[model samples]
Target: MELWYTEKHTDSVKFSIQVDRQLYSGQSEFQRIDVFDSKEFGRFLTLDGYMMLTEKDEFIYHEMMVHVPMAVHPAVKRVLIIGGGDGGAIRELVRYPTVEHIDLVEIDELVVEVCKKHLPQTACCFNDPRVHLHFEDGLRYIRHCEDEYDLIIVDSTDPFGPGEGLFTKEFYGNCYKALKADGIMVNQHESAFYADDAIAMQRAHKRIVQSFLISKVYQAHIPTYPSGHWLFGFASKKYHPTADLNGVKWNALGLKTRYYNTRLHAGCFALPNYVEEMLRDAE
Candidate 1:
């Protein structure tokens, strides 16, 4: 018998991976967590029956999430990550020698513990001295902060359940306040391929546009996600995602990344016509 792990991307569409074994399964106060090993994808994690990341393609998401903004912003010393308990974003972030501190705000401590135990490839950076972990409500955490960070990465789950509040205008407004005058905030902007995910994507883009002077959307392809096409939101008070990108300076860092490079950074922002239409309608 084959042990298959499946997630319903939509009511009529599902994705499955054949599993060699279930490595670990448990429930946190917030959501269900499961880890499985597979012949193709290696070890993968899921939350509440949703695919979060697989070992094979996790680098693409993490690198794009961190490097895009890091390349555009001239100097990013202090950083805040809202919901990356898995630490993949942190792993990419620590590569920048100019980054001095990172505050990771994760709602569920169990997510951190499980990933550290089962997915060390992405979770290994949690012990770095620059990383300070705070297991609390990210929404509440940002409300208390004002002009504190130079970069804010909202590496959150979908815009429902534990992540719903992070999508609201109130939260985006607070994020605006939580950053320095020239701060940049990058978030997982959901997918544009499905109706449900597209709605969430539009809603998030709309709110961020209202809060910041510079709001833009970019794309990356992650096979395990809804449609293999995922989006990231870039909002800033003082930087244009492409116009301000100092590709020369970023390339000088000599950080070797599998998916993100100076050239791809500029190309990712060229959205499809339909996606651009959706964003325009939302505006």
Candidate 2:
């Protein structure tokens, strides 16, 4: 008999995966988090019929998501991460010894518990002392916070249900205010290949341009995500993503990383011609 696992993504959505003898399934309040053992991707996490991360290839997603901003501000100390309960972003942030504090605001506590229990390698940094966990709405939390952070990493979900407010202009404006003078905010800006997401990027870019002096969208390849090409939005009041790395020390704690490095730091910003053309069209 063929085996198939099914999970309820939403009232209107469901996800299923099939293998020779194995079946895996789960259903979230909004999007079900399901894990499957695939030969090509190893262990993969899927939400609402969409792939969020894969074990063998997670480094590319986590590294590029974290390091691009860390490298931009080599002296990043106080950092804020929104919706990164799996600890992938925290794991990468702790690599820089200069970081003294990190606040992670995650809406769903269940995602954190599930990842920590079922996905150790992906959720290892949840136990890190420097990282503080606050289960709440990130948008509301940042608005009330008076402490200005050096870096704000928006490691949230796709814009649909719970994470919809994260992409709003008012949220972006609050993020700009919640940061220090030279602070930077990085957001996962969906896929360049997705026509629907292009409008989302344009909207975010418009908001950032009005608030921050420098705003740009960068691309990374994430196999698990839709379209396989992901976008990241960087907004800074002072520094550019590729201004100068003259005497900066990255991965300062002798941390071994699979994807992010000094060379990749510069190379990640090198966008494809099509992606560049799309951004140009937006302008």
TM-scores for all predictions: 0.99, 0.87
Model 2 residue 233 distance off true place after TM-score fit, in angstroms: 1.1
- For candidate 1, lDDT tens digit of each residue in 1-283? 9999999999999999999999889988999999999999999999888899999999999999999999999999999999999999999999998899999999999999999999999999998999999999999999999999999999998987899899999999999999999999998999999999999999999999999999999999899999999999999999999999999999999999899998999999999999999999999
The best candidate by TM-score is: 1
Candidate 1 Cα errors over 4 Å, as ranges: none
* lDDT for residue 137 in candidate 1, whole number 0-100: 97
Off by over 4 Å in 2: 1-29, 246-248, 251-253
Task: Please give the TM-score that candidate 2 achieves against the real structure.
Answer: 0.87
Best by lDDT: 1
User: After superposition on all CA atoms, how large is the RMSD of candidate 1?
Assistant: 0.6
Q: What is the per-residue lDDT of model 2 for residues 80-153, given as tens digits with 9 covering 90 to 100?
A: 99987777888888877779999999987877887886667679987778889998899899998653899999
**What local distance difference test score does each model get?**
0.96, 0.76
